[model samples]
Target: MVSVAEDVAIVAFEQTPSHAHFNDSEPAMIMPCVNSVIEQVGMDRHDIDFTIAGSCDYLSGMPFAFVMNIDAVGAWPPVYESHVEMDGAWALFEGFVRLQSGDIDTVLVSGSGKCSPGSYREGFSLQTDPYVHAPIGLDPRTQAGFQAQALIAAGKATERDFAEVVARSHANAKDNPYAQLSGDLSVDELLAEPYVQQPLRRLDCPPTSDGAAAMIIARADKARELCDNPVWIRAIDHRIDSHHPTLRDLTDSPSVRIAADRVGLHDGPVDIAELTVTYSPEEIILRDALGLNGETSVNPSGGPLTGSPFMAVGLTRVIELARAIRNGDGGRGVAHASSGPALQQNLLCVLEGDG
Candidate 1:
């Protein structure tokens, strides 16, 4: 586990509703979320010691597109900031590490994306190996199909299991106002729908969404001063597996297990777990990797399956778990994030309430 030099806690977080087509600039999507998080703690833009963001320039169809998002956070005064080309969860990783230096007291982390104007599947396919997978037109959906087939072949899960996960996710999403998709769906109803990919129905895939999320984190003392009940970040760890799909088991996530061990996920009972279940089959793989039992509530906010806003989806998981903890729904919880196709890289965060 990474040793904590100065304990960090999330004081406040906010996210925009996942929209099918935002029809706005990325900054417009981010402004409200950024404003709300700072307002939640009664802090001004200048009060934050540092700021960072996560986004994909490729998704914007322009290089250095992330630079344009600084308008939301205010660059006129010239704030110290940085950007990561991954998910907002990775930006949180950097923010958490920066605080350990003991020089910065607070950080503003944000992520936003607009996938409506472009083909997300084609865009994401570029992440594959250029020399191998990319040339064959292998996309995430096809990759997920392979994973589902592998699960069935291995007897680890069945098509019905995948349907059940989708049903539960939509059911749980009914309570999430920010969710773009939610309803009391049934496995039978979902199964009757035609398969977009064999063994993986259309419902098994995450919807393309446009949204943003922002969070304010601070050191222990500052966290206490900022919020009445701060959710402490107990441990955080991440790992990556081979980029080649052929090298992976498909049915298992060794990276998740390694990160889980490093974060001490089993040190105590888990009350909730918010995972990056972008695909239905991934939920089964993640559960097996994390060694979670029925006692732990998984994806209570409906997860990415309901509303997956590329850059913001991962960090939203952390935000959801923190919200649950603050509401007294649970004392301890785990939040997960993923990047790359077929869960190539994974991040896990453990959180706890002050009690």
Candidate 2:
């Protein structure tokens, strides 16, 4: 495992519901979450030594848009803050690293975005290679279709398997109040639906959503004082693969494998795993990469397939798994986050609750 000078734990977390159209500014959506997490930890805003956020400027159709989001965290107090052009999960990664310095005691982390007003597919195409993928409009959905086809061609999975993932995700989402889509869906019923991208049906994709999530993390000693049931962060590691899809094995995620190894994911029995299965086929790839078995409850919060708030989706996975561990649903769990196209980048966070 990655050794640390001092242990860190997530003391509190909050998230807004995934909305099809929030009809408001990004700050408006994020403020509530920030307030709720601060309240949960019973701390004043100034008590947080650092604050960081993650978001995409391309999605908002404005440059330096993340600066305006500071309104949600408040700037009048001149807080030490930072921003990442990636997902909020990356912000959490930075926050975790900052606490390791021992100079800072606490960090407030958040991620928010509004995909409703923008062309979700077109906006994300910018994340692709400008010399090839972007010009051809090879968006995430198209790439996901390619992944699904690769899975079938390799005989690793079938359409039925993809449908089953969707069916299970929607079913599990029923218990998640923040999920945008949830219901009883049969695998056969899902397979019958027309394909949005060949081999991948409509149900196999995530709904475009706008939402926000925030959390408070502190050093081990401060965490105990902040909350009665602190979820400890065991280890965090991230890795990336090639940007070109052709250079990679679509059916597998080597980055996830490396991160899992670095985090010592299989060091002990894992009670749950919250993976960033934005596409149904990704669930299979992630499952195989993480080497998780039936004993582990996967995506109990429904995962991104039910409601993808882009920037916030990955961080929400951490919050969901932390919530489960805190509720005594599990003693230890893993939360996975992904960025770039078709899981080109992956982050893993191992969490455990005090016995």
Candidate 3:
């Protein structure tokens, strides 16, 4: 196992339902989750040593949009706070690192996004290299399509496998109260559906969603006192591959492999893995990269395919994994999150129960 300088564990977590349109302000969407996590830990707002949030102003369609979200976590009493332009998962990463310095005992990490007011395809396209992909209007769906085609060409996966991923996700989502989509579906029926982007059917894509998530983590001593069952964070690591899609192999995820190894994903048994399979084909690539087999239950909460809330989706992966471990669903687990085009960047976190 990867050695850590200090013991850290997640004491509490909460998330809003994945909504197509939250019909409220971003702060309104975030406040409840923030309140719930604090309540879960029975801690006062001022008790949290640090607060960090992740969001995108472009997605919110306003400059300084994230500044307004601070209201959700409460800014009164002048608490120490920070923000990340990326996902809430990255904010969690920072919090995890800060706690290791032995200066902080508790931290709150959160992320939220509302995609109803903006064009995700157009907005996300700007994340691509301006001179090359952006001007050409190359968007994420098309990028995913390219990746799926590469998997087929490399003989790593087939369209049927993509269907199976979606089918399983929908089936498993039936048990997740926070999931936006859930139902039993057959792979054969899913494969018959028309494609949204060539080779990727509509079901293959994650629905555009608006949601928020928050989690409170603390050092070993504080965590033991705060909660009877804290999910210990064993190791965490993130890695990135070439940004330019052409320069990397799309059939496999090198970044995931690196992060998984660094986090010691296989040093012990993994009972469950919440992978960020934003696209159906991603499950295939990630499954192989992480070396997860049928014995390891993957995406028991249905993962991003059934409920993707953009900036918060990655953090939600961690929440799902932690919840499973806390509830005795597993003894150990690994959570995965990805950002950028075609899974260019990956983050992995390993967690274990008190058992």
Candidate 4:
């Protein structure tokens, strides 16, 4: 086998199929998938180099819900591990960063969320500044509401244009069993749907979903040794914005622009882009920032709109894109993730095939 000086590659990944009633306890949702991911990747729990997870405790109406969920990992005897209450996509970044040391070989990275409990809008409000912003009951969706207005004002996009995103995501989600919303609805039909928060229609917002996804990453040589097909990560990085969306330019995503540029996304035409835009309006911002035209394939996996299970949604984007590369779908692909209100945070990971 080659040495660890080579790039890292994904060995395997798995995400729970989105469902309406995942009434099972949080650990129940995590256990089966954890067992499946390790098996699919042909690795035993003892073989894991490290572990990291992401989840929102508010989703289950408790503090440190991830504590009990650790049982799913069987991470007894003190495995090198960590957790993030943020999106799993961000957690994946943490794992990727930690593996920079060659000493760590294969990692067990997963994220989960159960959105069926609290009002997503109310739960999201907690992300706002507690002192000044949270008191007003301002929700993240409300920020998107205003962003919808800005796009219309700039003539950059319109309600009808955003509706196209919803329609396409839904149609694509139909092919994705892990997707939460998959049904037939024409663009024109979606345009007529009522708005959930003015300017942003019901279809524009991602459905509250519960899901978990796992990815196995190994140093390039270990990857080659494990799988016949390997997707090598050429570049990866992430950025975060101010907590104050009002203090920032809500219409533009500088974080995305810088992140994609860090990974050289604008340098070439991206064959496939798995963008974690949870809202239809944010999709426009991501595409514009990436300088991607309609020719480039975007979100063939249905995206966050189809099945955003909170924390894990972002990590799932990376797993989906890596799967494409390993399957020989293309020479290169970019997976994008975001967090905070109205796309305030962004991460870019570029993967290339051996070819």
Candidate 5:
């Protein structure tokens, strides 16, 4: 439970658009973000203590997707590095752990995914329990619909409540050039749209997106040297809920709530919160569980409802949260990332501008 702010800090942060399409190949787009980060932080590629990344090929329809991004780092002279088949938040978690060892002064963490090339529903269905759920052919959207109905039945939420969340997200995305979907909608209009699934609709879910992002982490003194304002990590933690839908409560995401508290996200009211809730209704469950009220600025950048690129979604939340703190956009904030059906796995990071 040792916080990195007592030792390390986030010096630089960068990200690409969370859009629905890109003509560029995976590596082609990824390197630009990496290079942009390298230039912004005023560090040579070799100066990076270690490099780590996250990616998955199933969505990209190409195996070895992560291997292609290795070139992005100019990782010659064999800079120490590793990768995860998991989301970039997990990779970011690994990078922070390495930084905590007190040997390396800095590290770089990045992730990318292009989910626009194929039938994403067919693609995402594959992440389900291979034996039971896959055979049933349940896609993420449909599963979310089932969960939404259950939430209504449990009286935790109503159809109109979910629409309000979507309306807010789209409106918030208006100022974010990176957001894929932006609009001003009222609760009635969002509710009137036909459901894409029983309870989830086209607007409630994220479009398939293509994107990448990178961040720089440095020890305390080095963090201050690299940037006038450094966002210090107070805590980073993650946890998992049971994977089987029947075994869990779809109305509440225990994993997200627990992870947030574990990271001291509620030490006081956070000034900002970057949440990766891809579907609209999932936002309600996450917000309630984390004890957030109207005061906490949630997803000011529009979040994943604006765009979702599979494995890259989680890391983008972390990067945006760091940037908000480092740029004087906010004073204290919590970065919330999620994965799997109904927020099955979650990561919470608390960051502050103060050293």
Candidate 6:
């Protein structure tokens, strides 16, 4: 339970519009966001004390693919940098930890992905255990279908409930310019649609998207100098559970609950929560696990169900939370991210405006 030596806050954030095909390289997709955040704080690439990115090479069907993305952040001056194969939310976790050392005043964190070029079903199969699941080609959506089915069997939720979640997500997305899917739809209409997987329909899933997001975190001292409204990072905690889907209780997300506790989620009132609801059913599990009440605005920006860009989706959750706090939508909020099948791993970040 170590803590950061100095307070850190998100001073600026930026992201590219989610697109099915970006018509650009990963570096090109990431550069504008990187530039936007840096410009927001009136800093140059070299001015960033440390830079880290989160992305998956498997999506691009290549190794060391993240190396090329450094061009987006620039390397001419040789800055301290690193990369993670997970979502950018995890990269943000590292940046938060690095800032805790009190040696660096600023860090740039980013995540990006393009899912249009390859079969996500095939690409994601590699994440499964090679001996057991990979050989059988178990993908994320199929795993989610199992989770949705479990929720039904456990009587925790119903197909109508899934449709309702999708309906609400679309309604919320209408106002989100970055959202790829939006508009009003009825729950009955959604339920009548054919199922992509039993208990899950086409609308129950996130859109296949290509996108990138970046943010700047500054130490408390530097934060006051960086921006007028700095969304303070109150706490961040991430936990993982059994990776094998069969070993988990798909009806619940224990990792999320644990991370929430570690971050003191129940210690205060959460005004908003931006959850990574890639699968509509996930919202149910997350809401219950996080102990969120109806008063807590959930996914006001439509969440990943509107536009999911794989590695970038998790980080976008963090961006959304910061945006809410900055825009006077809320005073305090939580951002949640999940990786692996059926919420195998979860990260929770708590943020607050100036108190």
TM-score of each: 0.98, 0.99, 0.98, 0.95, 0.96, 0.98
Runs in model 4 with CA error above 4 Å?
1-6, 267-269
Score each candidate by Cα lDDT: 0.93, 0.93, 0.93, 0.81, 0.83, 0.92
Per-model RMSD to reference: 0.9, 0.8, 0.9, 2.7, 1.5, 1.0
Task: For residues 107-222, write the lDDT of model 6, one tens digit per residue.
Answer: 99999999999888889888989999999999999999999999999999999999889989889989998999999999999989998888799989888899999999999989
User: What are the runs in model 3 whose C-alpha is more than 4 Å off?
Assistant: none
TM accuracy, model 1: 0.98
Q: What C-alpha lDDT, on a 0 to 100 scale, does residue 19 get in candidate 3?
A: 97
The TM-score of predicted model 6 comes to 0.98
Q: Using lDDT as the measure, name the better of candidate 4 and candidate 6.
A: 6
Whole-model alpha-carbon lDDT for candidate 2: 0.93
Clashing pairs in 4: 88-311, 89-315
Candidate 5 lDDT, 1-355, residue by residue in tens: 4345446678777788886788878888788888988888899899889999988878667778788789887799899999987778888888888878888888888888888887767877888899998888778888788788989999989988888888889899898887888889988877889988878778888888999888888888888889887887778898999878889889998887778778877776598899988888888888888889889889988889988877788888878777767667888898887777778788888888873
lDDT for 198 (candidate 1): 94
Clash pairs (backbone) in predicted model 2 = none
> What's the lDDT for residue 47 in model 4?
82
**Candidate 2: misplaced stretches above 4 Å?**
none
Better of 5 and 6 by TM-score: 6
Error of 1 at 292 (Å): 0.4
- What TM-score number comes out for model 5? 0.96
